[model samples]
Target: MVVKRRFRQVFTSLKEHSRVSYAKIATIGGFCDLDLIVVKATSPDDLPLPDRYVHELLKIFSVSASSFRAFSLSFTRRFGKTHCWRVALKCLVLLHRLLRSLPDDSPFRSEILWTRSNGLLSLYPCHFLDDSSSASEDYTMFIRSYARLLDEVLDCLSIESKEAEEDEVLESLPDKMKEVGRMLEVLPQLQSIIDRVMDCRPTGASTRSFLVQSATKHIIRDSFICYTTFRKEIVMILDNLFQIPYRSSIAAFGIYKKAALQANQLSEFYDWCKFAGLCGSYEYPFIDRIPQIQVYALENFLNGMWQLTESSSSPASLLTSTMESPLSSTEDDSDKQLVIWEKVEENAFPRKLVKDEEEEPLLQWDVVDNGNWEDLLEASIGPCKASRNNLFYHSNGYGNNMGEYGQGEEANGWQMQLYNPYASNPFYQPQT
Candidate 1:
């Protein structure tokens, strides 16, 4: 009974601090080879291996395991609709659930807890963007935490400790970790799936307004350059496992092979112009605009993934705000959805640098080589272009005048769902 109560408190502490700590690692951790970023509060020498931190780490591990487990189990079946974005969401929810589980003999429950603003600005982009070292930290913390949790749970259940032992705990970590790596590798698949689904819906040419030829180019760039980075991280994680010898590596070996096959599909994006049907002549370079809506979606999806890896010390406010509301918009009455693309020729960001304001503008990036999609990824992050991803035009929170557009969630249910993950205003109060 004592253990359970203390563990409850211990977990609560973990939940609170882990939120900020995890974010730190996710953002800054990537720069340093994906190792776990242990943001020491006060000094590490002062705290040592405290009980509260142990319990919290345990919970974070269990949460990461359970979430990825679901993705692994679901992948051979139904992961496409939202696998790219959906898998990350499922992981965060599972992380929250795992932090709450506890056992009675919580030895380190009374350890000192701490927090600070330094936790932020670490810029943990998200798990997908984080590299092998940061990913390894997530793996290591998860294993250590799981070992402790498993031991405690067995004791509480009155099951023979011998029934479930140390080696078993250690063995479980690699499989769970590798599974997560595999799932994340497939994150880029979101674009292809979205494309296929939208394409399945017919478009009546008559109802279509302003069919932009450049949208295809934008999608291609996003698919290859942006999505490939995600896919590459997944491969890096899986490949890194080969360095660590474990039984789980055997299980992951097959998964790695499958991930490899999925990776092959990405090559098709190199010829995105062919698939998006953007081969026709254009007045401007059509393939370089930032797909702001899609990128925004990727950012939110990554944010949730990092939350799942965290130790659970964050408040709901930070978490809630991280889940931004979508831009509000009205739905077009047309039942047909267009698998149309947005133009990159008129990108608004980085304000095209021009020495000679000549009528025939110079291609700034000078990317005439359109043979591979990887070249597109070489183009760094810049300003956002106008979005067709969400139709802010559908009267989301717009005034009587067409110029006054608002993306308030209350004004448009559709817009709210899309923006709920990336915007910062979901927690904002609605005007009466």
Candidate 2:
């Protein structure tokens, strides 16, 4: 039996190698490097991938948008053809690492978001199963669950990217309400994925290979990070409700209930993680639950919001108008004029001129024009020399500095200062 299994493994490996070679030969002109990198990175084995190949793929993916496209195509094609669970898991791992390593604003990440939003990214073809043995069956189940979790991860990342973009314009009440609704939608999806993540544990001793153990550890870590983010988002949603004066009390109560329940579930999940030994050493902060008093306050707030909504034609604008600057009102014309005068006074002198005035007392020097300047210039062929004691020099040209006419010590004293209009005003005092 052992001999037959070894022979089958060797034959499978040889076949996979042939297929890879053929692929490389086929794509020799374009994306051969990418194909080679993916093949080596996801080598058909039950061992952890080497860091070197991952680094190489990252280097290629980071090259340009074209390289990102080529790598995605090559990796997808390679994974699609693969029939072994080891290679499929490795491909998922590579993708996870790449997504995690890519910056939030990376062009490639934006590309991923666009593709995912358009339903263009097709990663499901990478699924594979080798269920001839009990151990293989266990791995197959874990891989399916892992694939689902990864899909959720990608979706989560895309949602986060979109949320980041939306946050810039999320100041309005309607936008904030929409954002809260979107976040509420994301929580249920994330909780479902978390359930899947928790289910991907080892069933028996037969499935506890080094590779499985490593993958399980990563899944646990990623799940924990996701849960942490989930908890924070829920808390944020609950807190942001108070900032908006006019909101639906029924919806707010529903959100609070969902958050409180999820909080308990997340706490239990954390306990499970600790028991599983993957996260035993790490300590997660205890998230505070929503208080009953806060819920009552939210109810009253929302009830008031309903009244305001019925009474006001534009409740959101009316609420925000309360926070506007008093000077912005048309009734405060005198205050506005005073503010304008203060601003004009502040701009009376530029910062550089103000600093120069502060550093030195203003002194007036008489401009002594020599009638022998033309005769002296006509006599001298080269640059003229001027005395260093003079603080100013007159240049014949508009833009030409004093240095062009004379390269002497007088050029060193050629301080070009701007005229400060406020300097002549006796009433003007330098701003404190």
Best by lDDT: 2
| lDDT score, candidate 2 | 0.54
Which ranges in model 1 have alpha carbons more than 4 Å from their true place? 1-215, 243-255, 263-266, 269-272, 275-432
lDDT of 1 by residue, 191-220 (tens): 333233223221233112121122223333
Clash pairs, candidate 2, are none
lDDT of each: 0.30, 0.54
Q: Give the lowest summed-lDDT range of ten residues in model 1.
A: 108-117
> Can you give the TM-score per candidate against the true fold?
0.20, 0.55
User: What number of backbone clashes does candidate 2 have, counting pairs of residues 3 or more apart or in separate chains?
Assistant: 0
Q: Please list the residue runs of candidate 2 whose C-alpha ends up more than 4 Å from where it truly belongs after superposition.
A: 1-13, 17-32, 113-127, 131-134, 164-193, 202-207, 242-252, 283-432
Question: Every model's Cα RMSD, please?
Answer: 28.7, 24.3
